[model samples]
Target chain A: MDNQRNERKNLRRQRRIELGTQKRSPLGWTILWLIMVVFTIWTMFPIFWAVITSFKHTGDAFNPTFIPWVQFKPTLQGWHFVFITAGERTLRSLKNSILIASCSSALVLLLGAFAGYSLGRFVFRGWKNKDIAVWILSNRMFPPVAVVIPYFLFMRTLRLLDNPLAIIMAHTVLNLPLGVWLMMDFFRDLPRDLEDAAFIDGCSHLGAFFRIALPLAAPGLVAVYVLSFIFSWNEFIFVLVLGFHKATTIPILIAGALTSKGLEFWKVASISLIGIIPVVILTTFVSKFLVRGLTFGALKE
Target chain B: MKYAYRKHVIKWFFLLPCLAYLIVMAIFPLTWSLRLSFTKWLATIMENPEWTGITNFRDILFKDPRFWSALWFTVRFVFLTVVIQLGIGLGLAHLLHNNFRGRNFFRVLFLIPMACPPIAVAFLWKMMLHPDIGIINTALQTIGLAKVKWTTSVVVAPFTIVMVDVWEWTPFMFLVLFAAFQALPVEIYDAAAVDGASNFQVFRKITFPLVAPIIVTIVLIRIIDAFKLFELIFGITSAGPANATEALSFYVYLTGIKWMNLGKGSAMSWIFLLIVLGISLILLSRLRKKI
Candidate 1:
């Protein structure tokens, strides 16, 4: 009799579990669908507007109609204006931006990796190293404007104005402190056993670092590169102030377009679209690294 | 002894690149600006600067109306943007925190505005806010509301600038705060619910306090960033029909870069620098304590 009762209880419990699961699955799915719909609209609206406007003839863009309902023939004239007629200037700007952003990111990573490893591995005699790290991070606290004039004049004296190398130099100064702080955290999180084992097996410290540790920290290094690159690429103020006709960047081009009297709106929109393409593409593929980099040192293992 | 000396040399070698960049790019320029602030010089024609200690400061503080107005505008902009951005950001973060389909896509979408150039976003909004043929006016007119001049009216211009800033930057606050929210443990939330707390009560008693530090950090960062607001306002209105949106940063540009008054511009730059540094120090101490 007890066994039969137990079997009945088990059957009821199974039915309850089945019903709970059935109820939750549909509810979860509904919630998910709602979220996706709202989020897609919110995020895609402005970008859609920008791209569509870029395609529209000048008059239609000013009269602003919602996408798929606007009455106008789409034309590639804006793209032609931005890329072909202004192609030489735009291409020069793009080249300069690419060079500055790439070189600065590379330099920051190399320096940051070396210093990060040192901080992660060594302990010095004084409390000075900790203080130094703090000081380096604190440099980010200084407003960019405070140092702009000085940098301007210094560059002027050195005849580095309108030079891509000058912008790269300026960016490295701004990004290096943050890079070191972040890389230090990444390096510290890595286990010392690999290095220690390598050291024991007749490997030099440098060899252990290159052969064992550096490979292990590849993801973190990539994170640093993506972030530093993005920051440099998107940097506007220094570029605007420092770059002239010789080394104008995409941001400078966009700013100039907006400021010019009676400038073609469609052309400005087209350039804006083009300016964001690289950033959007980079962020889409490497968002994981970007997010990780932003949250660096925030989460302690 | 030899090995110890060699290790020291290697350590310094690793530090050389960064130190070199810092000294040339950061230290030298900063010192030059500080020294230039106390001297009077014209960039256009004069090579030698005449010593004018405290004169530039006196002129700016006592004589320049634009300087004071710009200072007031910056303070107001920073305060309003920080509060509104943080409030909206927190709300959106909370709303989106639960397990939902398309959360990942939503997260990416929310970050889109931040990733795009600020100047581009500003220009887009300017197109939308245009009075005669703009969509915003058209929608209002369709709904039987009178058309409002957004950029031309001085009173409306600063407000429009604020709105543009909010539209472009609220997403940034949302992204950062969402990350903070995700870092929160679920067990504590469950415990709150078990104690007969409503969802709102659970959020108030548990989630809000847990996220306060991050919220403060975000606010502080926004304060510093807002003070640097230039591109958007510059693009949309160029400090407006009546200098309504003439922020301190823009003012510095006008005085120094446009007007060629290096002495006054240097003074203004120094003042802004000091203010930024002071606020930054406060934030640094707060962050340090939290960590």
Candidate 2:
């Protein structure tokens, strides 16, 4: 009985020691929480500044105080400039951005889905599967500088400068590769049994792809489309170089605000806030897919 | 059997549009640029390029200090910003890995900056860092510190650009590392814990080695992307204060578009392309070998 009590006492002391080491100091926990709070503040500060500055008048914009509503009354003049005075140009840019982003993304999706389905599902005679996919991705890996001059001269030769179609075509060059990489992984995940079953039931291969496989990959399709749209929407140099007055995207418009004499921070802020809202909202939905797509499907959750 | 043969023929049609588009847009331009880099036609002087046989490449390689300076600036920017971003991102990922209230909210908040428009980021930062009336300077003076010339001083401008890059892209590293942290094998960590490993010991021995591959992948991709830093510099300083922040891509833009030096610009671009391709090929080959 005495030996048993001694054994129990030793076990109790070991548990106490483990608890002592594992129990984190409250001060350390507080410091970590404080760091995360500071990080969040850092992340949100510029965005918050842009939003508030958009609501401020030209005078209030330079108030230098963090408080927006309390320092002075907020004005809608910046919004008025964006919506009414500069309305035509701003709306045209917005419409152009929407059109270009949507069209390029759609074209990329259609063409990429076809290629991705083929790559993921079939074995071509001459080309290896991995080589073809890597070649497609390598096209994306090339620096945009290599193509800008030639594209400019080529577009000039074709008389397609300042055309929305021209920018759409330019954007497709970037988005299509991304589309193929993304959809290849997505379609590859799907069970081959479904398509084989459909084929055995007398459906054509293409019909089976459309009727059986496409519907199953609908969510992936949406993810790819949204991601490509965000990319095209955020793309700057292509639209800047390829399109001028008629095909100016929102990024170009925001950039134009910077070059004008006596920079209007409030006006720039308003346009910028509007420009980012769509992309920011869209990205949150597909955050998981964004990481997957950006890493070229090498990393997945 | 006939239908199967026909199916094979139809399958080729699916890849044609994308392949053709890439050929016309990507391949043709690349070859054309390769040809252009060998010529000496200024856009304003001549209607057609005059084939001058490696003269453009020679000037860019040996004579042009501007090209070298811009390339150096790009390299330094990529190195500093990526290192800082990895450090911060890893820390944030570790801190948030713990289960806690409001963790998801913080993750969403952290990701907001990554999605903001680059142009907007530039303009907002430009206004916020304006020396005389900027909020940052105001706050500094309020605390009895001297004002900082954030983007104005030549010595500080490049670093300022790096700061913006870190702010904008650190979340990308965070999200990636966070995802990687989640996907780690739980059993190994549990076994390590049961083995009485200290937290640092567990991380150093088990976590770091496994996570190193993804870290390397992030570094490789970030280096490639950061080498093409144009929009931020274009919007923020426009490579201002005597071209202190002229990254190679922006240099190419100024040469080709602003100055209309298409021949030389094309030359610089090809040289830059070869460098990028070389580096990427090396990294990719190493990655393949490892896998």
Candidate 3:
């Protein structure tokens, strides 16, 4: 009976000690949480503001205070401005951006996959292949501006300025290199035995690549596709200079709106929201794939 | 014999489209620009009759003050933005390294700026820094500080550009560095703690040394990126209250598009490219070794 009572007393003492430790340390946790909360608010507020401001009337934009509740008098005037008021210019820009981004990404993927497969599977003629890959990367090192003058002159001479094709072609120039580089890395990680097996089964080289390698590289393809698409979508310099009025993209439009002098905050905010919506949707859906894609071969053994 | 020839032709065909695109879009333009840099021509009305070989390059290098100033400005902006961005990024990554509630949410939130188009962020920040109605000024006034013209003056305009850049990009650094930090083995940290080292000491001695390579890599990348900074500054200040923010890239825009001085612009652009290429080559060689 004495031992049981002493054991119970010790248990109570230990429980109290654990509770004390837990209680005492929450101060540090609270401070850390507070800092994080503040940062979260700071990071998210501008984006939130842009979204909210998009649904607001132009007059309501200049108001000094932020209202927590959505105004019942909320208007789609800003959205109207973006879609309707800007004439067919906005629609044209959107269509052009879509065309350029999609086509460029598709081309990049097809070519990149082929190039990546070759680099991965075949031991080419010499160190020449590696040098070729390096040279391709070096092309990206040249600033877009360096080539802009000549591109402008070339496009103008060819009557291709203000055309979506110009931007598409330019975007491909940059995107292809990136795609090849990334896809090569992806292809490098793939197992060789699978290809060997396909070859042993009497499949031709292309057939084996298609059957064994291509399917396995789907995630890498998706990653490169998404990256190329986003890059082409967000690309400003080539689009801005080459496709001024005819091939205006959302970036160029936003730039034009912002720099147009008057404090058209509502319009700017609305256009910005439109510009970001697709990317936000994309991020939420494929964020997992993005993590894997972006960190390709980084943590691999 | 015909079958072998056909196979060789097919192989070349496979490589043809990409090679053609590169030649037309990249190689052709590069060479054209190099040649045009030596000839005086107006892009708007293309009647170039004279070759001024090396004059354009000479003028840009020796005679032009704007070119030198623009180069210096670009270098300065790149240096400042890269350093501050990396510092804040590393600090934030460190702060968020330990596990906590809502860690995933915080990570997602921090990545928002990077995912958003830079053009939009530039406009949003421009609005937020408006002289009279901006929240920044309002906050300053509320705190009993005098409201100064943020973007209206020469001195403050460049500073504002840098600040906006830091705000938009520090998160990028945070994301990259956070991944690097998370990749570090926890046992190393545990060993350091068991040796009675303080958190700061462990971070300084062990954590930093391990992550230094990544930090250097990020800094070099950011420096290269900063040299190409265009849209944000173009949207915000248009290279200035008084050319205070006229970076090398912006100068390329102003010269080529705005003034239509194709020869001078092409020459200036080539020079900028050469500088960036030089830096990138050094970094790329280092990166190849590290990777």
Candidate 4:
């Protein structure tokens, strides 16, 4: 034991001597700081511009000034347009977006939890787990455009076009695959010993899953829920093709403003700012989960 | 026997709804689309589609110049966006890889663009790219440069689409690669340093090789996702400036829904699917080896 400790200490010294502290020079640090500042400006500039655009009055909206408060007087006209005159449409779409995103996320989590439990916990003779997992993920590979045609025809046939129900079902189809993959990763990371302990305590498999695994995977559930909600809220193609008047979303409205004559910059910017509020809030809350969710747990930070 | 039956029932009961949903939503629609591609369907509620056997594909392949142009446009768009996004994303990742004050704050700020909805981002760019009042043109003019048309000119519209995509998704690449950089074993760097390797040499030999697979994966994923480019064009250009910026997905949208040419649309979509799937299979196979 003494010899082992001495050898470990020697190895540490050797490592330190070889690596030479790995410190950056002041000049290097200054250059890095400059790069970072430039990047920060690049990332924030467009969003800032949108905010500035949203605040401008109709005349000032077309003003070619980059500075917001200095070059032009800011006004509440765009906000008023978003909230009051076009208020009903905005409120209706916002309601539809919220209802659809939440309900579909609930459905996805409920259904996906079951599927994930099965895949993560059990191994069958004929069903190779990896292949099954890959197959489930492959469902997400088909571009929404590829499938929108049939969905359109089917919705038309069912007379469910422009209905929020249709949008919810479509959103569920889009997010359920993602939900399964995410929950599968969560469950796989959890040790089976806990479930075994529950089984010994007279909990059946389903009870063990619900009582033991589900409670423990609450963070995973939040990650899944937030992601699915954001995805459903941000969906554009299905809403465009499927909805008409009754179920139009904020994204559709924003896109529509582009086609109308005389680019209503302030109104479009205001509506867009309103549109991204829910997503922005949710993403800020789950920013830590963003990378894991994006890569499907391929690279965990 | 009863216990075994119950076990089997519970297991499948959990799995069946998801399978059934995919079958109805994914498989059924795809098969229907394939069948629709082979017929001449004008999308009348009452009229039956006439079976027209491969003519749609033949036309799209040989006769349609727009189809080929759109396909080439999409390829160029994907290639340019992938290159630019990777470059900017890597630069940002490298900058943030070191310890710095407010690093976490900047990292979160970088992710904001991606977190915003794609439609909103596109519209935001539209607001910025307005030839008359857009901050971009305004900035250009302020700098004593000629203000260029961003999304309205035929020559520049495609590049504008690529720019919007790069703005929205470069963060995605940065986040992925940043995580990869964080996970890299510092001992390797230390050992290389001990060998008196120069900083550029260490980066070129040690860092680049370690990050290459991730770079590949990120690029492949970006290519696959870029093929589904629709919202940006739909929101920003609407496939306009004379169809200069029409991606394959936007073309699919135009042919099928806007034109109401269901048969031709279906054909275009199937061909699109085949190409996307072909690339995806290659990605998947390569991914299998790496992971």
Candidate 5:
């Protein structure tokens, strides 16, 4: 143990020496800081712009003011307008957005989790699993524009237009392929031993999956869940085409803010802020796992 | 009996609904569009659908200059956005790779743009990019430069879309590549260090080759998404300034929804579908080999 400790100490020292090349010069760090500062400013500018614009009065909104009080006084008018003036409509749309996004994402997640498990764990005789997964992923690439017109007509025919159910159904199709693809990769990456071990302990197949596999795949599930939710929350064309009056979402409302009289920047900014906030929160929380989810667990870091 | 039940019953039970839903929602519409493509069916006209076989496809393929231009513009948009996004994203990933304070915070911040709804992002940028009163031109004036027409000028309007697209999507490339960067084998770097490889050499020989696969996948994904560029166009330019920025999907939206020419729109969409399908096939095959 003493020798091992001494060897480790020596190895760490040697590592430090060799890692000297990895060290950036003072000039390098200054350049890095400059780049990072610029990048950060660039990344934050639009959000900052929106936040500030959202607070400004309609007259003050067009001006290039960077501050709340210094450049121009801020007001609650935009927020008030968002929550009160358009209160009934805004609140309804907000509720619709939440309900559609949550309900559809949950449905997609449940079906995806089950299908992903089967694809990840089970072998079928009739077709290749690879082919099925590839097919499912191919669906993710299907453009919404191609289907929107038909869905519009189809929903209108069924009197499903302006219904949350229609939007939910559309969003389910929009996100299911992604969810199943991500979850399949998740389940496939998981070791089979836990479930097998559960089985040996007399746990039923369903029990093993519920108690063991599901718990283990939680991180991947969370990643896909947030992703599906984000996509559904942000979906525009479906909500725009299929449901507008009764089932208006934040995107449709944002589009509505593009009034024929010309865009009222203050109003647009406020609504955009509402649309952005949930996704911002979701992305921040699940960002680490989201990278894996994006590539369908291809890079396992 | 138990084994068979678990295998067949469970597998089908798990799989069928996903496939079935996709069929109802995606395949059904797609096939309906395919049928619509071969006919002359204007949604505005109240008539039995006229089955005009191959005319829509032939016109879109051979006659319509607008279709060609939209496809061309979309192709340019995809190429430029994907390439620029990859370079900046990979650079950002590499720069952010080293341990630092507030690293995660910055990562999340960078990712915020990509997460913002594309329509909202476009609206925010549109407000900023206004030529006369927008903040972007406002900034240029403050910086002692002449104001530029960000959206109204025919020449610059298309690039305005590209710039906003890069702003909104470069984070996606950054996130995926940064994750790939994190997953790079440290031992190889250490070995390269021991062998006295230069930083450039290490990046070129080790890092580039290692993350090449991810770069491919992410770029392909970005290209696929970019091909469906409607929200940004719809929100910002609406294919304005002589239709210089009219993307394929936007053109399809115009053809199908705006004009109510369902047949021609559906045909154009099928062509668009084939192009995307081709790319996705390649992407999936590459992805299949990786996983």
Candidate 6:
């Protein structure tokens, strides 16, 4: 008992030193914090400049002012131009982005869940599960430009160009493979006993899946939801080509801020923030699940 | 629990939609593009696609100087961006994995760059890199340095793309690796230390080999996505300063869409697809073996 206690004490002490919480000089910490501070500034200064520039008057936008009241005055000119005065088209695009992203992600989850559950839980002849999963992932990996050109022509042929449906269909195709691959892992990780017990209780396979496995995998679903939504939301190429006029999204709106007079810094910054804020909220919501979800569980042990 | 083979009916019901949908959307389009690759037809001008077997492929491989230059540019861009991101990101992850004062605040700040879409990120950098009125140049000049022509200069234009990409993506690499590090068993490190292993030795022998799989996976993902670099070029440079930053994706877009050379664009994109597929396969197979 005495030897065991001493060994335990040594182990705890070793952990402390390894974590740099013990036996570290102030000089070392100062350098670490110094690196952190520099990294933070590199990460933030552009955004800090943008935040100030967004609120600055168009005339003051060129002045390189970091402070609002002292160095320069803040105005709503940028916000007003992007929202109030020329706001009609901008609002329409924001609505379009939200709708297209959500709708397509929902479609992806709907089809992907069933497919994922089937692939995970059941066996099919002539189609290996591993090969099927890899095929879906390979589709996801194909360059979007390859799809966009052909998709542009196809949408035009179908008279669906510039319709939100065209963009929605495109997003569903891009994200569904990812959804299936992610959801398959989640469903496969769930215990078979609960599902089997439900089946023994006269629950049909579909019933057991709907009542048991899905609730258990609800947390993972939220992860895939946010992942797909963000991909669909931030997408520009498909929207640039297929959703050209009626279905344009915020990224394109920000891009459109470039005019013959050059980009109005205030205008571009405001529009970009509009595009960024939703993703920030969504990512934070599912951040804990992200390591698994974002990497398709490639890092999962 | 011997469930009936009858459930195979339901199983196919669940799986067939995804397969059918992908076939129509992915397989069908790819097949069509493959067919288009052999023809000589500008969709905008030519009424019918004229069959010209192997001509488009031959011309693109041999005669197109811009194609070779664009390929060179893309390779360099992917190499520089991935290497730099991996280096800084791994270092940051190792440092930030430890708990410290105000760590949470810095963590939250780091997450912000990844939140912005690629186009908006390019714009944010463009505003900062503006030669005269931009904050970066203003700071430089105030400290007694010459300003850069960020958009117009050939050398600086491509560098700016790499810079913006590094800033935007390093957080992703850092976050993923940080989580991987956090998930590691700390006891092993303590044991290594007790055995008289130096810090560098511990990292080399234990930490790296353990996380080697994760590194390979993220690097493979980054490389594949980096080859698809499009939004930054479109938003910031439009391959300006005389095509200095024209990526393969941009070149494909220019040839296929903007210039309306459908046949050639199709061929170039097929080549692009094959190259990406080949790299991803090699990396992916290595990853499988590692894990």
Error of 1 at B240 (Å): 1.8
Identify the candidate with maximal lDDT: 5
Clash number for every model? Answer: 1, 0, 0, 0, 0, 0
Best-to-worst DockQ order: 5, 6, 4, 2, 3, 1
Which tens-of-lDDT digit does each residue in A88-169 have in candidate 1?
Answer: 9889888887899899999889988887777666664575556556656666666676667777777888899999888888
- Cα lDDT tens digits for candidate 5, A65-122: 8888899999988899889988999999999999999999999889899889989999
| Better structure of 1 and 5 per lDDT | 5
Model 1 lDDT, residue B231, Cα: 81
CAPRI grade of model 1: acceptable
Model 4, span A225-261: residue lDDT tens: 9988988888999999999899998788777766557
TM-score of each: 0.89, 0.94, 0.89, 0.94, 0.94, 0.94
iRMS per model in Å? 4.9, 4.1, 5.6, 2.6, 2.2, 2.3
Judged by TM-score relative to the true structure, which candidate is superior, 1 or 2?
Answer: 2
Q: Among all windows of ten consecutive residues in candidate 2 chain B, which has the lowest summed lDDT?
A: B282-291
What stretches of model 2 exceed 4 Å from their correct place? A1-22, B1-7, B286-291
Query: Which parts of model 5 are misplaced by more than 4 Å?
Result: A1-22, A191-194, A197-204, A296-301, B99-101
Clashing residue pairs, backbone N/CA/C < 3 A, model 2:
none
For model 4, how does the per-residue alpha-carbon lDDT over B48-105 read when each residue is reduced to its tens digit?
7889999999999999999999999999999999999999888777666645457577
What's the C-alpha lDDT at position B219 in model 6? 88
Error of 6 at B4 (Å): 2.2
For model 2 the local lDDT of residue A284 reads: 81
Task: For candidate 6, give the docking quality class from DockQ.
Answer: medium
What are the DockQ scores of the candidates, in order?
0.38, 0.50, 0.40, 0.57, 0.65, 0.60
Model 6: how far residue A151 lies from native, Å: 0.7
